[model samples]
Target: MTILLVEDDEVDVMNVKRAFKKNNISNPLVVASNGIEALEVLRSVSPDRPRPKIVLLDLNMPRMGGIEFLKEIRQDPELSSLSVFVMTTSNEDSDKIEAFNLNVAGYILKPLSMDRFISAVSTLNSYWTLCEFPG
Candidate 1:
C-alpha cells in the first residue's frame, strides 16, 4: 500500500520514516511538505497507479493547512472517498472535533518516544495490510 505523509517538519518526517523502516513497512512512501503539494500529488493519481491507500496528515502547515486540505478533498467528486488521518501534535479539543467533523479516518497525537512511534507505525501498517479496500 502506498502511504502519503503530509507534514512540514523535516525532523518529524525523518522520524516517521525511521519508524516505518523499523516496523518493516516497505510500501513506497510519498511525502508532501504542505497541503498544496499534497493536493497536487492526489490530483495526479491515475487508473494506471492506484491512489494512496492512506494519508497521514499534519494540521499545522505553511500554506494550506490540513483542515483546508480535507475540505478540498470533500468538495472534489473524484477524491471524496480518499481516507485521511490527522497525526499531529495539536492536542486541542477543537482540532480533534473539527477533524472528526471533516470525516477523518483517525486523529493520532504524535508519539514523542521512538519506541512508541515505531509501535504506532507498526499498528498502522498492520491495519492497512489487513483492512479490505472498497471496490
Candidate 2:
C-alpha cells in the first residue's frame, strides 16, 4: 500500500524515507509538501496511479494545514473514508482534540531523536502489515 506523507520540512521528509528504507518497508511512498499539494495528489483519478492507503500528515504547513485538510477530506464523499494519521510536532491538547474530532486513525508526535522516529515508523509498519484496508 502506498503511504502519502504531507510534510514541508526537507529534513523530516528525508528522515521518513530513511526510516522506511532502514526498516525494510517496501511499500510505495508518495510525498506532498503541503495540504494543497496533498489534496491534488489524493484527488487525482489517473488509472495507473495508486491511491494512498494512508496519509501521514503534519499540522503546520504553508497554504493549508492538517486540520483544514482533514475537514476538506471528511466533507468530500469520495475521500471521507480514506485513513489519515497525524504525525506532527504539536503536543497541544487543542490540536489533539481537533484531530480526533476529524476522525484521524491515530495521532503521533514526531520524536526528536532519529532512533525513536525510526522505531515509531517500524511500529506503524508492523501494525499496517497486519491490517486489511479497503481498495
| Highest-TM-score candidate | 2
Clashing pairs in 2: none
Give the lDDT of residue 99 in candidate 1.
92
Q: After superposition, how far is residue 18 of candidate 2 from its true place, in Å?
A: 0.5
Q: lDDT values of the candidates?
A: 0.88, 0.92
Worst 10 residues of 2 by lDDT: 45-54
lDDT against true structure, model 2: 0.92
Candidate 1 lDDT over 37-125, as tens digits, reads 99888889778766776899999999999999998988998878877889999999999998999899888898568888888888888
Candidate RMSDs in order: 1.4, 1.0
The local distance difference test score of model 1 is 0.88
Per-residue lDDT tens digits for candidate 2, residues 18-107, read 999999999989999999999999999577887787899999999999999999999999889888989999999999999999999899
Clashing pairs in 1: none
Residue 48 miss distance in model 2 (angstroms): 1.3
Q: After superposition, how far is residue 31 of candidate 2 from its true place, in Å?
A: 0.7
Let me know the TM-score candidate 2 reaches against the reference structure.
Answer: 0.96
